[model samples]
Target: MRSKAAVRARCLSYTGCVGILVLSCFLISSCGNRRIVDHIKLIQSAGYDLDGKRVRSTILIGDYTEKEKTNIKILSTESVSSMDTMQRQNTKSNQSLHTGQMRLVLFGKQFAKQGIGSVLDRLFHDQFISSRLRLAVSGTNAAGLLSSTVNTHDTLFIMNMVEQNEEWGNLPKLNLQTSLYNYYGAGRDLFLPYLILEGGTVKIDGIALFKDDKFATNVDIRDAFVLKLLTENSRNGSILMPLKESDALPDDYILMRSIASKRTIQLVSQEPAPVILIKIKMKVSVREKPEYIRFETKEDISALERKLAAYLVKKAEDFISLCKSKQVDPIGLGDFMRSKSRGWNEKDFQASYPSLKAKIRIDLKIVQSSLSQ
Candidate 1:
């Protein structure tokens, strides 16, 4: 009954309405696609190991509830690729697997000994994984380490241990960025703290030495303490030395607190030998007073300083010997070479590392002592 022009206008209006509806629907669907699983399982820690030709990945999952408590779940898979393994895991779970909250990545002894470059490359290339996550080597099986329960003062005990270690300066802070940097460094060697489960408690055991993506050996906690003192400028810990005047000094241990340390390394071309000269200056506080010695004069202070210096120098020499024996460069010798020399190659440098002689000198100063008696 309407005119032809009016009918055409009405049809155009209807078409416009249809287009608007389609646009609204498209927007809603786009938003829906963006909505992944709401209750996603977040990985707190992960471990990697070699299982035949494939890599075995284990993830320690955790979730938070209204009560503010953590519930942990473990998921593991083996596949040719880490991504593939993750995808397979997603199929088995009702919620999506997320590594957004990942705190640590552990490598098994065998897996690390074999080679970790491929696995580490994959991690470095992943976008979802954070570069700030801490890296550690398991003292035992990586999978077992993650799965074992730890009891501590805090609810999330394992997480607390790592956080405290960083805050207290017990071990060198290792994150994904540090790991990648070490990977590309001149010696292609990296050292990570080893975590061991003992008496249902997790502890930072020692330093795990790595060479070109393979685990070379472990330096005990005592050795790690010396290594940290040598490399880092600031340290807050106790060291035990024998008392001066006691015939049976076995009962006496002087606890020295490191205040400051300066380390300098230089390469020398001496006759019939290639040598690296290391000079260390350290200031320490005497925390434990020995029962056998009376601190009455400057001469006593000088004697104590000399003794401490000798002890530190001996420890450093021992560490250098251990590194040569294991063929691992944890002191950043490669870095030293690369920084000092223009045309230094890692391959040639590593070959010469074992026989390379070292000259270490330690100058110690006693800043303060609580032992006045």
Candidate 2:
């Protein structure tokens, strides 16, 4: 029989050996899967355009020679499907193309109108693709925008532009994950940021409304600001309001900047048809107002707030009317109704959507002022 100390020593040796074996296997597996950043082409951005019956896909990849410097490579190919287009592009690339680091994907107006359901589905199913990828619709052609010589120095130019607008400008917050949720989930249609190239420069033009993955129409950035107000809380979003004559302002225009906002949707009366009353309470600051109008008194401020409220209500109603006319539900009113009502039928709602009554009420409060003297 072995002594107790000797047996314990043998057991400890065995455990150490097993641990070393497992660590060695892990290291080997990790090495096998290791990808050299310099050798692989990481796609930074991609775009899809409709080219007659086929699809024209453009991919932007950045080649880094050192830590800070990068060279952008643009490639274009045409195929029946986006997947096939990518496969064809890979053949032309010197190194293996990877999408793990992809930041944005753009769809041309024509391509988006044709329907991006299948293409979006393919992206959602990809294991390496990020859910937070930014997706947008080009006001013109996506291929043209991607292949443009403008902003070639920075591969993330378009992405950063869109991001900044969403953060401080009038654009809404959106990403692939949120888009996919709205697209796949019931009661709401998908909407994307719309980009247009003006004077060889890319700019956020508006918001594109979608009807079942097909582009329906677009609203200008001002209207997009209104849409953002209805859907979510907005901060630092500015809009130029046309002041009414009754407001007693010398100038017809005043720029109101949203400091914060909160909205409530009430489903009023579900019989026959559903009526929605959307109430928005926004805290705002005057970015630019008529020099004659002094906000020193509470009554003066109250009058200005009332004027802003009336303008906002009119704008919101007009926008809702536009959505109803186009048969698009970017506001997700149906979803809100569905949450309130039991046994909601999408078909029934859609049928009555055009005639569905909605009322907008805005309560604007002036929290600060930075008027031009």
Every model: Cα RMSD to truth: 7.5, 2.9
lDDT of 1 by residue, 25-73 (tens): 9988887435354567776778887777677888776655536566666
- Model 2 error, position 3 (Å): 9.1
At residue 34, candidate 2 shows an lDDT of 69
* Clash pairs for candidate 1: none
Off by over 4 Å in 1: 1-38, 50-55, 79-83, 150-156, 242-250, 270-272, 369-373
Which regions in candidate 2 have their CA more than 4 angstroms from the true location? 1-18, 21-33, 149-152, 244-251, 371-373
TM-score for all predictions?
0.82, 0.92
lDDT of each: 0.74, 0.88
Return the number of clashes found in candidate 2: 0
Candidate 1 has its poorest 10 consecutive residues by lDDT at 149-158
